[model samples]
Target: MFTPRTPRIVAARRLQRRRDRDQTGRFLAEGPQAVREALAADAVLELFATPAAIERYPDLAAQAPELSPVTDDALAALAETVQPQGLVAICEQNDVSIGEALAKEPRLVAVVAEIRDPGNAGTVLRTADAAGAGAVIFAGDAVDPYNGKCVRSSAGSLFHVDVVRSPLSVVDLLQDNGLQVLATSGTGEDDVDSLLDGGHLAPRTAWLFGSEAHGLPADLLSSADRRVRVPIYGGAESLNLAAAAAVCLYASARAQR
Candidate 1:
């Protein structure tokens, strides 16, 4: 079993930090489900697990010829969570460009702009994948997609969907590709349900969502092909970024079907 001081273990532990991940172009996938998905995506470069974890998921271990067994303390050191799940994999980055993602003619896409919360960002990624979105784009000043919290929150869906990070021109890029970029707002001109039922959620569509703290910027809202709002029948003030994304993405998914 590998000790905490092992060179490989030490290197993998460095991946928990954003700077190290950015420099190495690799990130850590924690837990059995995430590791399994990363392996399926062919993104895992190396697998590290505790002896118990390797024993519990022998099939997972079999898939990784480079599996290394480590002590429980070593596993915890590699994990970002309070309670480590005992399994972690060092994975190569998988982010693509906007043009590359659009080349495949995605029917539904989720465009996240300036979102800071890693958990929310990851949940959005997971939701987009579940809703059959062809891509999930992190635009503007968004959180790092490879952030450990983001990867963990995405469960296994990070591997299931194409993820992109655009510095600034995401809207322009989507529009140039003939996609209808629809921004969401609390007081949008069109109702989300109405658009869905009317079959107006365009075939080649991208749903634009803003950050958790603030909704979309005014210029962005005005620039969209259309501004849509999810109607609130109940007394809730508003939905959070993740919840709104799930609703909008699923709506587009059902419409496309």
Candidate 2:
């Protein structure tokens, strides 16, 4: 077994389960993009990169002053993925509320409800960042935004976006702030395109999507101002939630532009 040079850091990584991370108010971001974004955003407390990964991304070393170049075994020891590479960073998680995020200078928001897939949630956040959304809201039963897998899947976009976690009250708060809380569902009168065509996409709208398997909770579904679906021509039952959210948010982006 390969031993860690920095025992304290290694011990912390070994102890960094989801609950431990939540309690400590810290999380790890894995991969080159994640580490770079964290450094660029000044969100990282510490950075750890391996020799090979550092060789591939020398700019990262130039960017973050407090980086540690360690062996691949050490980097792999801290990672949650099967193939951890490039870099990793420990950063403080944002404790801001969805209510606060809704109250900020954002016209577009992507609402993720009960989205169990880390890839879906991360992709939605990435899309929101690309769309210049004010915030990405993780409503009830959603996956943890700070999960290492989520951070990696986001492809560095997490650093540019405001991620919020909260209950359903923020939905009403969004409405009060001139936002239209539109949910995506199979049974809907108007499609997403119709809403966008009618110019409803610019009013600080919230594009709500659901989990892959269960969809949004029924109560939350009923609470939406509008239930809309994406029109499909292929034999697919539904577009992946991340793809759907991307389409919705980007459509809003194009409409606003």
Best candidate according to TM-score: 1
Q: Per-model C-alpha lDDT, please?
A: 0.88, 0.78
**10 residues in a row with least lDDT, candidate 1:** 77-86
Mark the 10 consecutive residues where model 2 has the least summed lDDT. 1-10
Once superposed on the true structure, which residue ranges of model 2 sit more than 4 Å away at CA? 52-56
TM-score of each: 0.96, 0.91
- For 160-180, candidate 2 gives per-residue lDDT tens digits of 878888774456777787888
For candidate 2, give the lDDT of residue 70: 75
Q: What is the C-alpha RMSD of each candidate to the true structure, in Å?
A: 1.2, 2.3
The per-prediction tally of clashing pairs is: 0, 0
Local lDDT at 152 for model 2: 76
